[model samples]
Target chain A: MRSKKEKKEIFLFLPRKKPFTDWSKLLKNDFKLKHFYKSKDLLSALLFSPPQAILYYFNRNRTVFENLLQLKHNFNLVSLAIILVLEEEDLEKLSDDRILSLIDDIILTSSTPLELKIRLSLCLHRLTRISDNNPLTGLPGNVSIELAIKKALESEVPLAIGYVDLDNFKAYNDIYGFSAGDEVIKNLARILQTTILEKTTNAFLGHIGGDDFVFIVPLSMAEEISKEVIQKFNALLPAFLNEEDLKRGYFIAKDRQGVLREIPLLSVSIALVPITKGKFKHPGEVAARAAQVKSVVKKIPGSNYFIDRRA
Target chain B: MADPSEKRKEVKKKIRKLEGLPALPPIIQKLNALIEDERSSLTQIADLIEKDQVITTKVLRLANSAFYGFPRKVSTVQQAMMLLGINVLKILIMTSSIFEIISKEDVGLWEHSVGVAACAKILAEMKEVSDPQEIATAGLLHDLGKVVQMIAFKEDYEEVKRKVEDGLSPLQAELEVFGIDHAEMGAFLMMQWNLPERLIEMVNSHHDLSRSKKYRKESALLHLADLLVHARGYGETTYVGLPPFDPKALTILKVDPSEIKEIYLKLEPRLYELKFFTEELKREMT
Candidate 1:
């Protein structure tokens, strides 16, 4: 069953070099590699079989560089990844900006097998993570949020993780429908992003799909950022709700079990977890802590945040 | 002769001053609004398109065209809407109105457009592109600028044709006489009409595939469709050889050089069908 998956082939175009038999043996199981010796043959082979990726061994030849750039334009380097293998001295001697721009990564030829594997894994991981952004809100999604959290933890920053979601959002969505709900989510994303930008230069805002959003800011600025987000969201709520709903302060909505209830106008609840808790290592731990705070915060009436103090 | 830059400025002024390029029919705007409105129903869009008798007939004809290949005949506006969906139907209506302008100016150009549209449809389907109808629409409207030049600037059009007869390729003649070629002109008109940006880019950069960033694959397919139609001598032409094939576009499109023969073989029968399709449309209009 695994073999039924379409194998992603890589085209390897390299100049004459010593002992590349080992290179072929290295990639044989993972990728079906097609080797091209002459520059002209590379063009023809690319025309016939468009590869998932390209591995080019760099040289100082002008014609080779031109052909590669032309090929990149043809294949759209945005969709396809091109990795360049070059020696340190040759890379310095060539010093060509055009070649550097066309390629996605440069792997020094002197790197060990384990190093090359790790670099390729990291490159693929980054590509998939970037492409996984939410389509509606265009914010980093769950995978990217996890990766960002992991990176922030590794960097040893005094990070404060805030998990934010809407209060009474389900009732609003039930009345207004999915499209209006989507607009509300997008508006919240904008508010969170703008409020964080106003407070600090370095912060990350991510959407975990639906109406849920998460942000990571420095520990000192957490309360300020959360307050600003609540204020901004509160100001925009009247515009989203009708005049009658605004005046009445609540609207008739059905609870999940089909009971009619008067739900208050939309508000937000944010759970802030400071990562200096010593017990939190991975993103899962941070998310678990946020959930515990969120349960307590939702019991309040208006938009507010609850910080986890149970460390 | 004036310098190329000076002549280009003059041509730009001429384009700006010219009138009678049909206003993009009001129906297209309504259709865009309908597409954007979350509450809009398909029946509403179908009823709106049906209000315009001219577009109604064209949309019905396209729904029945060999390109769509519905097993049963799609006879009514509602039936056509169900089969073709809203986006494809929107493009069909837009192209049908645009084709009114193309068919009025020259029958040969109309035939050529039909040929390219058929070829692009086949190419896109073979490549498994998500929207074959959009690609075919791009192929059909790729030469729209030439129609504008023929209608808007007769004297310049005569000079361009004369240069073509004197043995410069059609593109080279267009450049010598008009400063800019028909690709840029068609792209400019598309932009003015508020067509989708991808379609506009396809028209603007079909001649130069490298310049296209977002719609390069679509543009490359249109470029090759134009060349294939010209190769078969089906469209209006002065009998120059196939336009220069960008090796880069071929690579990007992933079309094997050997597959050209197979594509042509598949396109021939479709061209014959579209020929009848064009004539029937013309007869209905008259």
Candidate 2:
């Protein structure tokens, strides 16, 4: 209900010391600012009314900054931009990729008010470009998916990357319109997302373009997550299909070869490839194995997953 | 006072840009507890949301919103919750405002809607309707226009009630006062929100079976369910007696006369189950 014309809210956490540049004059008329001295206060306020961005003046309190970042991840506050303000002496901290990935941008204490304002606006603009989420499902797109896979390859903990897609999806899409097809895709995305999120917090799920999805989870939880996803997908499938198609259990549609035949109802196929440290050098190798596993899973029919056992 | 025609236009324009309706406080409190509890399953949270019409509509609206790129496909609470993860749902519950200090009449209306939803789902199951949950959703939201009237057009709503007290039927009173009935008003808003067409049709035609074109059976089922709940006295509505019953609903649903008793028998236990929750909500309101 918040109107577009309303001033964007920015939560500022500055030190009580009077040595810094005046923030009020700098952000005057451009933003509605709420000042927070304590990190806990800002966090509690976020629960009720989240601001467009958080300007945290980071000192030596590494724990507080890390806790704030963890809270953002725990609550999935991906859109709430965090701009860190650091002293020039603390410039070396920017070399940490973890901190860099977590915060939107950094502002040096010596920058003028005009430079600070421009940096804030640029940070907000970059937030949009960085979010490569699939518009339909709001899941991360190929860019993030590749990054996640690369991270998984380097992870010391054993991880499983599941390549998920639909069998008979094209036939269903052909019979039903594009809107219904999109619904099925969204439904599958939900199944994968919720099932994976329920199992572990160290997991990643993304849409690898139309009908294709990828999820990275601990190797131990991969099978259970896949089974749950398949079960949920099957249970919610009937809601999307018409009574006639549901009654017949399949619909008559043309196959890719242009021959008319009865195509089975939509079913999901997940090809899970497990990764241990130093097993696969690149994400491409994992993709190659998953592609092979997917062929086997797709041939078996019904909703199922195939875990690649070969090294 | 504005002319009835002008008032109708104003209401339509307001609903077209409608953001949300205020939900009862108790429901929001209960939802927050359910969502914040780490042990609660998604189904449990979804079940709680399904009980309240306002929250249910809001959930469906968000899931089917253009931002999600699922403009009318998502219908059930479970489906919507799946798309909107628990974190987003938590934020939604926190932002949801309550009706300006809950009143007894509002509680009564909430109970009535829950009752109708239950009864409709029962009938849908009995008739082997596809997507019975969606039908139940339509049942819960069937009276949404009345809620809109209470919030946006307080004077017009009071006027309709006064006319009803003077022996005019609630529908006739609404038509005379607002130049549009609640059924049409609710449907207009639903269409504006881009809800599923089947749901819109069912809500739009709950009173008049003739208006239902594609989803006649579903609409007829809701019509019968509304009457049955009213007859059972589970909740209160503006109607002094049973609103005009279209016997054709029974014919359209292919429900036999003997099935009426069966429906009542099936509905009694569900209403009894819901009574506990409604009573608790009332206690909290006071």
Candidate 3:
């Protein structure tokens, strides 16, 4: 529904009965601003039509600010820039990661109109640069995926980087059409995402384009998360396949060579590459090891995962 | 009075295009408390959500909406919560309107649905059915048609309730008043929402076992769970006594007379737990 030509929408939540700086005169030319005096109105509007950014003037309503931050995190509203307008004394609150991580940028209440304008533009500009989410699943794309892996490699904590892909996906697309294929991919993405989230909060999930995905979790949680993903994928697969194909457990589709063959129904293969302090030098090395593990996992039966046990 | 058949068609059309349904205020309140708490696990939140059918269905509808591109794939609350995440859930609970100014009767109906959900899960586990949580979901949603009737067809719903009070059976009153029963009406909405076919089948056939073909066992389990919950007097329905039970449900689900007692024993504690939670919510509401 969003078009490039449309004026960027920004929601402004300001304190009631306060003599704060009016932003309408400054922002009217470049943006569409809707003002909200009540927190409920602001939240409901956010749900109905999420603005590109929320300009919240901080005051005594710290709870409202926290709720906004939580909403931004939970909904994964990466594109919604939350710019806080607070007094200089409020700068101490920024030290809290919970508050710091959620807000896109901050502006002082005493700042000139020009400073506010520049900061808002910079926040919006940064969102475009960092938004590497896959269009299909809205998950972090290849760019973030690589950065997450690189961070894991450099971090001292042991972590597991999982490379997930679908088995027989090409055949599924050929038989059921492209839309159906996309549904399967999204389903897998959900399974991976939710499973990872359910297991631990300190995890990363990204869509590496098409049917492939990448998830990074603590090393101890890798196998458990993989098992859960496989279990959930197998459980939810029936909804995507036709009843006849589900009953037969396979469908006759043309192979890459153009010969008819009994292709198995969709299943997931997760290649887990564990990273210790110095197990891998870079993200590429991790990918190469995952490729080797993936070959082994794909060769086995339906919805399987294999962890690279080698040093 | 309008022709029941004509009314049925109109109601079906409305439900097919139904956009939103209100949830019980108490459930929404409980959800807020749970979600705001820093330590509430996803499973814990999903457990509370599964107790209320209206919220459960709404959650599933959002997850399976065409916008998500996974229509009919995300059936259970746990799965839907995973995909929707905790943040969206906070907004959903905050934004969800209260059920037409909550009444004691609506709270009772909520209790009945939760009781049936608990009983169905126990039965599913006893029978070793795959995805007991899903069967529990079916039980929770079995009376979604009643909710639709109450919200969309208020006059006719009161008429049906009055007829039941006048000594007619609930299903008979429903058929005479609306040309269709709650089971089928709820099923139709579920189908329109693109919920899983198995779930739709179970909801459609909860009152009538013969209507179920593929998921007869699940339907039968839900049917029995409904009866057991009613008999326990854990919650109130339009029926003064137990609704008609299909004897064949026992055979289909392979439940024995002794096993019924066992299910009751298992259900007692869960209902007790849920009762405490609901009572707390009611107190908070007051």
- C-alpha lDDT values of all predictions: 0.68, 0.83, 0.83
Q: What is the C-alpha RMSD of each candidate to the true structure, in Å?
A: 21.5, 5.4, 5.9
Question: For model 3, what is the error of residue A148's alpha carbon versus the real structure, in angstroms, after optimal superposition?
Answer: 3.5
| Tens digit per residue, CA lDDT, model 1, B166-233 | 88888888888778888898777555433456667887887789769887888888888888898898
CAPRI-wise, candidate 3 is: acceptable
Scanning candidate 3 chain A in windows of ten residues, the lowest lDDT window is A15-24
For model 1, how does the per-residue alpha-carbon lDDT over A83-134 read when each residue is reduced to its tens digit?
A: 7778888777556766665677878888765566566656655665666667
lDDT of 3 at B23: 80
lDDT of 1 at B153: 67
Angstrom error at residue B176, model 2 = 2.5
lDDT (C-alpha) at residue A265 in model 3? 87
**Cα lDDT, model 3, residue A191:** 71
Error of 2 at B72 (Å): 0.5
Q: Residues B165-283, candidate 2, lDDT per residue (tens digit)?
A: 99999998998888889999999988877788999999999999999999899999999999999988877889868989999998989999999999999989999999999999888
| Order of the predicted models by TM-score, top scorer first | 2, 3, 1
- Residue B229 of model 1, lDDT score: 90
With a 3 Å backbone cut-off (N, CA, C), the pairs that clash in candidate 2 are: none
**Tens-digit lDDT string for candidate 3 (A241-275):** 87689879898999999999999888899999889
